[model samples]
Target chain A: MARHVDVGDLVDRARQRQPRAVARLISLVEDASPQLRDVAAALAPHTGRAQVVGLTGSPGVGKSTTTSALVSAYRARGLRVGVLAVDPSSPFSGGALLGDRIRMQDHATDPDVFIRSMATRGHLGGMAWATPQALRVLDAAGFDVVLIETVGVGQSEVDVVALADTTLVLLAPGMGDGIQAAKAGILEIADVFVVNKADRDGAETTVRELKYMISLGRREVRGASWRQPICKTVAARAEGVEEVVAAVAEHRRWTESHGEFAERRRHRARTEVEAIALESLRARLSARHGEALDGLAGKVMAGDLDPYAAADSLIADIKAEG
Target chain B: MARHVDVGDLVDRARQRQPRAVARLISLVEDASPQLRDVAAALAPHTGRAQVVGLTGSPGVGKSTTTSALVSAYRARGLRVGVLAVDPSSPFSGGALLGDRIRMQDHATDPDVFIRSMATRGHLGGMAWATPQALRVLDAAGFDVVLIETVGVGQSEVDVVALADTTLVLLAPGMGDGIQAAKAGILEIADVFVVNKADRDGAETTVRELKYMISLGRREVRGASWRQPICKTVAARAEGVEEVVAAVAEHRRWTESHGEFAERRRHRARTEVEAIALESLRARLSARHGEALDGLAGKVMAGDLDPYAAADSLIADIKAEG
Candidate 1:
């Protein structure tokens, strides 16, 4: 629309502590517009200043509560923090439901803590295409730490963990049948594991189950305790809350010492750039050959030819058109 | 890599009854290679011939059982059916962990049925990228109906259903939390609502809750029956399986009569192509610039500038190099 926003200018404006510029930069990356992707690419160097922690769990497992507690812990340590709470968007409205964001009001009045609610707008990618870009904005915004909370415990939610330096998976007692969180990929990548709502029944059983599951799947990496620590917490009561925070800090130390933190972030950066580049390119191709593609689609629908063959012809046609 | 495998040749071989050809065709689409996107564009027109039915629910809702029963019912009707059992990939091994393919035991030896289990392999779009091409392959391979079973409930799973002609959402009894599925976007896309494991306790209550939620959320659409039918079934016993099949057919009939089926399928086809194009472009860009991008990422980690600004420089450098 306006030759797309320059990622560099967006980054510069965001550097100047401009909210609208930060929002615009996130939009550019999320939309994966060609111009915006370019800008995001330019801003990629300023990331890694902040420690990224991913918080994920089954819905209603007190992930928000845990995130709120984590924010408080960081604030108590006199550290600035940013929380990117990802919420599911209504398919009909394409807006965030914001149900979980209501639980994160403890830090609303604290200027040191910045929280943003994002909706996964069915943007081909489960997370809005711009999420990594948004994270970069948070990274550059001078926050000492940024915590990403996924909407749910699905594959896309798992991807959110991959984008973080330390992933903390929150689990609750008596949630579902005996299916452990690791079985769903939640327990696999977690640098630290947290069992929230420990005041409930089956807390011991849940802890035992998580321990067993982690033992079954734990990978031994050099110089780092890959053993996913089990921290019990009653989030609402703030009981054992500081222990979870300590576990996160311990994890950061282990990752940094083992040099895995920089390695993982580098890989994530590559993945983010690659994914955005592809999304942008595809949008471009779709706009150019949409009509010819429609014509071919009509012919295939008429039962004149099969889809594979039809695809072949269309590719040739697109090449010729180009 | 051999010019990325010719889409037409692969299609022709597949049409000529070559099994490996079909497998390779699927691999192409799954990889979302630049060449395969073209193949998918050509394949979309021939897709509407098959009845694309989507099955989704929360993890461990007996969704796999329900899908198995429905596939068995459709096969008994003398229809050639293709089952795409989508499961989450193991985070460690990057493959199907529980072996979803083995779960469809009844269809194993039936020539008229083709069963395939797919996992989301850390792709930004996950199964969304591979689904349409996979469906097109099955459609062109002469399957009368294609069933898509998603791994988890949320927006991505809902997107899978939106691409289908009929969507059946399964809920098991005793899950007081099934209402969360409705709130999370599963209820809106359901052509047929299924309360699976009807033999269990609280089945009736689950159905009542679903009905209540549906009633509250239902909106009137012109010539569209937004009344999602709640069908109960004991999947383990294969009881009430026929009614589920009947409901799917009934929904198909109504949509066809109102011309919504054809239109939705058309929209789905185009969207599928767009997804492929984007994924392909991503794959290509990632391949070409992955290492150079990684080099820039090292500096980003060292905090030379903001990550956003770093990304901008990398994108510009890549464009200039090209």
Candidate 2:
């Protein structure tokens, strides 16, 4: 077993806005250490402060550049910031490419900025399983803003919306059209849409298409009252990034004024709690009922039992064990 | 409650190769109807016969066209084929756009060719939860080959590999370089690489880059003895598609000769069983522990308890209730 981390010391240091301490707490959560329960208990009181913002787009759509620009803008406001990049490519250690790391090196030396990448290696639940805990660690660490970046690819990647108070869906010229956006389901999760690389040709066309798509009212409006704002940004040059940041802040204001802020956070908390409980039950079931499960699988394979019937029997066995 | 579906009648009709019966069985799996257990029990013996092949790529990578061509090729071989298009855009029903539906009209009238679209609307587990059951339905319904087609954009879309005997990763020229392929992790999941749209510019470059990447030996090499083959196809004109089909058959032969076929199926069965059990436990937990869960969520929200601790408490309560 790994040596026990000192939860109290870590909490105290994190409360003091120490990036190393915050990173350590997140590492514990990522590793799922035995002391995670104690760490969670220690940090609970300090959370629910940071505004969680999610940035997602198709790969090569300048998500990182836009994220970096947003970070700089937030830091310019003299607020502490935390970045959690859920990297699908590297699911083992949450490793970022050297180029990506160098791109964000502007904030690397700042003590008020904490950046961490999380890998989804063993997480079958995808971002739904690991992200909320990491967000809590950053939230408790006194960051005023937390930026969660994930590559928009498939269904589970959209879960970032569940964790963020504001979600920016990024697009670039020549990537695809409004039909592709609608097909990818990004329109549904986006609170603010950012058209990056605005200097490129067809930028205006992309903007027009996005505006038309938003006007369609096909997206499942979360709050039903907030109209999503579309902003164009040349993030590489830091142009229009401030406008994007301002739109995010406007969303925050809207949600708060409408009393959706607390409601959203409460819902997020409930989801996190439920996910944790479900994972725990699954872990216990596998650990204790390994043989029985194997037996059930054998029967299913042999056509003596269906998977549903086998599942019912397995659940019964777990209940009986309890 | 919906009336119980007659498992025996459905199975008999499906086994007789009735498209309506197969469709109904898949609908039950998608709706997660109560009679699904009986259906699975009846279908269990009839599965492990059809070859499950999964074709996935980014949107606009010609997945549907390639799928249609492959269906035609299999039909030419006098083999019945079933196509399941997991449409992300249409969540309520597994409905395809008119254009896509029309593209497959050639096979639509053939009774031996059963094509169904599955919506991922409410499924949080992605393909892991529903695709296997649907595959079982088709497999039991006497299809010689089941083509699983998904718009591969994100992480969870990779789950199709778990249910496929052979997974074909499709790419098109002008999409990107091998680096983008590596970033998407498609290279790892691909048992065979199909450079679709080979008539387009940079097709040779795409094929060469993919060959170089595969030569790097980065993929896990599942069976360890057989090397992945890269094939090029202009799926639109049906050129080179037969070669792709030949590659798929070669792979199947290799796996069978190496005894990897049965091994892969067994592994798939184990994963399917575990997922079902986990889903069942979650449903039961919500049904039985609603109030306790709500209380725990309240505590977590109020900061009186951390989510991890609350999750522990919730699990203990569940055990105690049992």
Give the top-scoring candidate (DockQ): 2
* Location of the lowest summed lDDT over 10 successive residues in candidate 1 chain B: B92-101
Candidate 1 global lDDT:
0.69
* Docking level of model 2: medium
Q: Put down candidate 1 lDDT per residue, A1-322, tens digits, no spaces.
A: 4574556777787777666776676666555555753665566556668888898876657777888888888899999888887766654324434444566767877767778777676555547345676787777767789999875556666666688888888888766532535445566667777888899888899888777666655563223455668899998888888998888888888887878877788777666655444544444455667785666556556654444454444444433542
Q: Which portions of model 1 miss their true places by more than 4 Å? A: A1-47, A92-99, A126-128, A177-183, A220-225, A299-322, B1-48, B91-94, B97-103, B154-156, B173-179, B198-205, B220-225, B299-322
lDDT of 1 at A143: 78
- List the RMSD of every prediction in angstroms: 4.9, 2.4
Residue range A71-190, candidate 2, lDDT tens digits: 999999999999998776542112455556888898899999888877776345646767898998988888999999887757767765567999999988876666566666677778
- Per-candidate TM vs. native? 0.82, 0.94
In model 2, what are the clashing residue pairs, if there are any?
A: A153-B153, A153-B154, A154-B154
Fnat: each model in turn: 0.24, 0.45
Worst 10 residues of 2 chain B by lDDT: B89-98
